[model samples]
Target: MKIGLYFGSFNPIHIGHLVIANHLAEYSDLDQIWFVVTPHNPFKKKNSLLDNYQRLEMVYLATKDYAKLKPSDIEFNLPQPNYTVNTLAYLQDKHPDHEFALIMGEDNLKSFHKWKNYQVILENHHIYVYPRITKNIEASQFDGHEKIHAIDAPIMELSSTFIRKAIKARKNVEPMLPKNVWEYLDEMNFYR
Candidate 1:
């Protein structure tokens, strides 16, 4: 099986995320896209994040109906400030029968060179990059590597940060998030 790892904080899995995952599953060669909920991202602020379990639950609610899209809690057990290289290595080791790839946005690719062991990641796994607003990835920078693929998936300007801010302002978030996820957030009074 070819699995694409879509890692994120998923602070509250929003419609934009679901849209991206759906497009990837429908249009790409990936057999499955696992939404790896990171417990903590070294590049992001820790205090603003919701608890890992809550974030994981939101992902579960958002992806419940999609068989090809799975919510993963693998990073919850991993060490804090999880590095993508380490997580990918561990997953590859544990699931040798399954081929793994990394799914990311064009914005992340801009900073790809700064990531720990980026060269190993590029050599060992394929990177499926989707477009993001205001971030353009230069293909030439990668020297036309066959492993680096640009996917023609739908790009949404929406982000988890926007959703959190909206919720805090008591703004309607139904249009931005899955119904179940919105309901869960309202029920838990999260991000208020």
Candidate 2:
């Protein structure tokens, strides 16, 4: 099976995340899209993030209905400030029978070179890039890279940061989040 690992903090899982996962699962060669909830992203601020378990739970609630989409807490047990290469190596070692690929957006691609052992990741695994609203990365940038695949997934303008801010301001975020996730947020009073 070909699995696409969609890594993110998922502070609160939003519609944008679901749309991309569903698009990749339906349109790409990937058999499944796993939302690998990172405990802490090296490139992001840890203070602003929700608890790792809370974020993971939101991911579970948001994606439970999708057959091809699954929430993963694989990084929770790993070292803090997890690196993609390490997670990939670990997954490869644990699930040798399944071929794993990466699913990211054009924005992430713009900063791909900054990631730890990015070259190793590019050399060993396929990278599926979805279009991002503000990013303008062209296929020509990765013209010589056969493993880099550009997908025509829809661009979602909504972002987790925006949702978080809206929630903090006591604004309605029901439309941006999945029903279960929103209910969970309401129950927990998250980000308020």
Candidate 3:
């Protein structure tokens, strides 16, 4: 099976994430899209993140209704300060029968070169890039690269940060997230 790994903290799984994943799963060559919830991202601040299981639960709630989308806690058991290259390697070893690709935003493409062992990653896996509203341009080296495929998915500007802040400020941000995810967050009183 061809799976596209959509890696993120998913601090709280929101509609923006579902839109992109659903678009990729339905429109791209990928058969399924896995939400690889990272326990710790080297580039992101750990302080702002919720517990790994809590974040995973939100992802489960958000993606449960979609057959093509599935939540994965693959990184939770992996070592801390998770890096993309390492996780990719681990997945490749464990799921040798499956062909794994990457799902990322155009904003992340701008910094693709900075990732550890980026050359090795590009050589082994394909990257499906979705549109993002970012000022920085993608690296020239990635332009027209065979390994990187630019998908014409919808541009989602909504962010988990915005949702979290809205909830904390006592504002209604229900429309921003999946209904079950919003209910889960509200029930748990998270981000407040």
Candidate with top lDDT is 3
What tens-digit string does per-residue lDDT give for candidate 1 at 39-142? Answer: 88888779998998999999999998999999999888888778999998999999999999999888888789999999999989999988887735355476
Scored against the true structure, residue 154 in model 1 reaches a CA lDDT of 86
Models ranked on lDDT: 3, 2, 1
* Clashing residue pairs found in predicted model 1: none
Clashes of each: 0, 0, 0
TM-score of 1: 0.96
Deviation (Å) of 190 in candidate 1: 0.6
Q: What are the per-residue Cα lDDT tens digits for candidate 3 across 1-192?
A: 999999999998899999999999999999999999998888778999999899999999999888999999998888887789999999999999999999998878888999999999999999999988767563567999999999999999999999889999999999898999988999999999
Off by over 4 Å in 1: 135-140
Cα error, candidate 1, residue 134 (Å) = 1.3
Model 3, position 39: C-alpha lDDT score: 88
Compared to the true structure, candidate 2 yields what TM-score?
0.95
lDDT of each: 0.90, 0.90, 0.93
Native-to-model Cα distance after best TM-score fit, residue 171 in candidate 3, in Å:
0.7
Candidate 1 lDDT score at position 27: 90
> What local lDDT score does residue 174 receive in model 3, on the 0 to 100 scale?
92
RMSD of 1: 1.4
For residues 1-192, could you state the per-residue lDDT of candidate 2 as single tens digits? 999999998988899999999999999899999999988887777999889889999998888888999999999999876799999999999999999999988888877888899899988999998887774545545655899998999889899999999999999999999999999999998999
